[model samples]
Target: IDVDKSVDLTNCDREPIHLLGHTQGFGCFIALRFDWIIAYSSANTNDYFGADSDDVIASPLKNWIDPQTLHDIRSAYQASTITGRNERLFSRAIEATGVPVDISIHHNGTFIIIEFEKITDDRVPEDSFVRSMLSQFHRYSDSQELINSTAQYIQFLTGYDRVMVYQFLPDGAGEVIAEAKNENIDSFFGLRYPASDIPKQARALYLKNLLRVIHDVDSEPVPILPEAEDAEDSIDLSFSTLRAVSPIHIEYLKNMGVKASMSVSLIINGKLWGLIACHHYSPLIPSYFVRTELELFAEVFSLELSSRLMREREDESNRVRNVHNQVMASIGSEGSLLGLLEKQFDTMRALIQCDGIGAVIDEDYRTAGTALSADWVHQLTRYLNRQASSEVITVDSLEKVLKNYDTSSDKIAGVLAIPVSKSPRDYLLFFRMAQTQTVNWAGNPEKPVSFGPNGSRLIPRSSFALWQQTHDDRCEHWSDVDVRSGDSLRVTLLEVIIRHFQERSELQS
Candidate 1:
């Protein structure tokens, strides 16, 4: 891919970032073949190794480092190969410059890539400090409390201008659910950003690489010498610690008045769930050790979050199940499904979290909570029956699904239809009232594209002002637990309907 080619929002996702053939200036990279011979080196290798690319390329690894350092590299290489991950050697002395540096070694299929960054901050957090942070996390069982505490702890540790827990919504947009920022800076809490801000390819890379750091967005990238004639065949830097930043992304950060940034992926069940995004207003290059610690923190946080969500789901399921058992017991004692539901309508509504509940049994319609006209309930039942599926049907926006219906007056925006019988198409429908709310966006999301430096390509918006948008004609989305409860209720009601018919037939005979 041509890095300098003009691109618009439509084609930006096709950018080949892994084949950029460069590294950040803060660190130097070297790729060694299987025989320990250097195959590729960053153009700025002489700055650290005191050897030009011409002299280092094709040379044995022993030519640059002392024998002891060479032995250590080999050991780290072996460990990386065994673990299938990058191995780190911190605070190692470079014999040529006599400077202490941190080394990261990894095997990229055909070559061993080694990255070096000079040691700047040698300070390590005390064990007690780490324990204290973990203990803070342990004190919060609520998801929001945990998320907010994470932002606070990260900002406290890194001293960034701002740290946000940005969660991905269903529409691919991101929302800043929690934030910690310096007193002088404006808050970005509760603000949303369009999906274009982080394109699809960028999200895929974040999933593969758990952490990314942009030390200095304005610094020039050091090109890799002997750049592959064909960009597709360039050395893959997918896992490099010092991979060059995409030009467009640099422009994005600059527009936001940021000089440095770091993002830690929060993955759940092998999916990209959210991000821990940190921004610095000035150039800041954290030591590799500190970055590594942050990576560990993100991993531990993801696990705890996944476990907490699963436990909450289980508790909700248990509560719904208890309500369902009560409803079933009442039906058995009354020997009439309609009689039991009409008498204990509120209890039936508790089977799921919804604003109202309605049931349609052979020519009879019963409703509780929010009132719905019998004609409208019958019309919705006919609409659902046409689908010809026995499974639960959930719709968050009734207008989107039912085109000609006048749903604005009813103010019921969501529906969960559980099919109880196939012949008559009896349904137990859960309805939710429409809600109107304001969304705070970091900028006008619709105007994301603007002329770039060349005026030919589309770049990110140049502003970060708060833009508010009012959203209506929708209700609270039905969660996975709600759907599951609906399905469970569907199955139980089907069994009851079948037995009732069987007993009626026997009595008539």
Candidate 2:
């Protein structure tokens, strides 16, 4: 009987019956004695006949077995079975049959856990797996929740620490969208990293190596193929999995206090959207089988997220196209134009994920929009005039460009400037919360002190709460990207606001 039990075989009750056990299952056989006993991957039990030998399987078990009885059993079994000339040979032939038990024992009573090899999808239809995965995505597409349900589903499929959906700005800065993580871990939902954190070179590299796993940052190095050194651009995976942890990156992670890292790229419309970062508390090297499984899962997630985003953007673009036509018809009517253009702020707010929404646009190209505050308007007008002069304009760092602006107002930390039309003249401006907030973390701000080979002391990390000195900084603590599904509540509220603007624009126009 090809009996298969999910529980460890050694833990099963085979009492009162003499048993022949091998490898991990040998423990059960040790509790009973039969007329004749045949064991493999087991140790002699003379030292503690009544005691468990699970801890000392490394030593020979020959001491416990009666030599004459063992010899007789070996001769009889070999004669009856005619399996092979030697016990080791028989074990090898059995293992070649792809049976798990073969790896559990050898005739000499030694145990060896065969290095698990690869699992090919050829044994299972690839199309069926992909189709099954797509079926899982249906729940997300059918929902109206603004939270990154797409990211959440991916996290479920791939067992990784908080699978976060991160949005990367052109300058390398990024924000977390959705995340799910271990309950004990403190969230990094709203934390922001400077553009320098992910340099241009790193971003480019991600395009080709879409998935990466850095397990056991402190593990010993596995050298590459010595003969392949002459090939300049060759990628050798032979021993890459065993490569040593990078010193530079170790220091980088130590600075961030991240022990393990795995990342999958999210591409939308052939553009980089963000990444799904999986973190671990200790060294965790996943086998190739697990890595492939995650990659397959991530690919499905990227496709779904891209498809959904494209559909939504298409709907918005179509609405905008129709609305623009209506606004043209009512160009002379200021109230109609105001209603038609009122949604500009809402759209900008959605894209940037801001707290406050405000816009400045000309009524028939006449006046600017309402001022957030008297001081805010003054700074905005000057910035708008500067935008008018540039033929081709794109604002990368609004904080740096708008330094003269009064960002000190309320919770406004960032601004979104969008040109209303192809013409570069005075255009629309939106205000909102900046991605990075000023916070006063509870612990020491300085990085941990380090002791070098020569015992040199290192400085600790910075923990000053200086970023949160003002009222604006206390508004929100963004979650790490993957765990932001709970933030759907905010997105739902914004959807209503967006609907209001869409209705007013259509009706008033």
Backbone atom clashes (below 3 Å) for every candidate: 0, 30
Listed in order, each prediction's TM-score against the native is: 0.80, 0.49
Residue range 312-368, candidate 1, lDDT tens digits: 878877887787677666554325667655665676677776778888888698888
The numbered model that scores best in lDDT is: 1
**Scored by Cα lDDT, where does model 1 land?**
0.79
lDDT (C-alpha, whole model) for all candidates: 0.79, 0.41
User: Candidate 2, residue 123: CA error in Å?
Assistant: 17
Candidate 2, residue 312: Cα displacement in angstroms equals 1.3
Q: Give the alpha carbon lDDT tens digit for every residue of 406-507 in model 2.
A: 344434554444443333233344444433334323333243334332122121122111222222323232323211321332333233335545666777
lDDT of 1 at 364: 92
For model 1, name the residue pairs that clash.
none
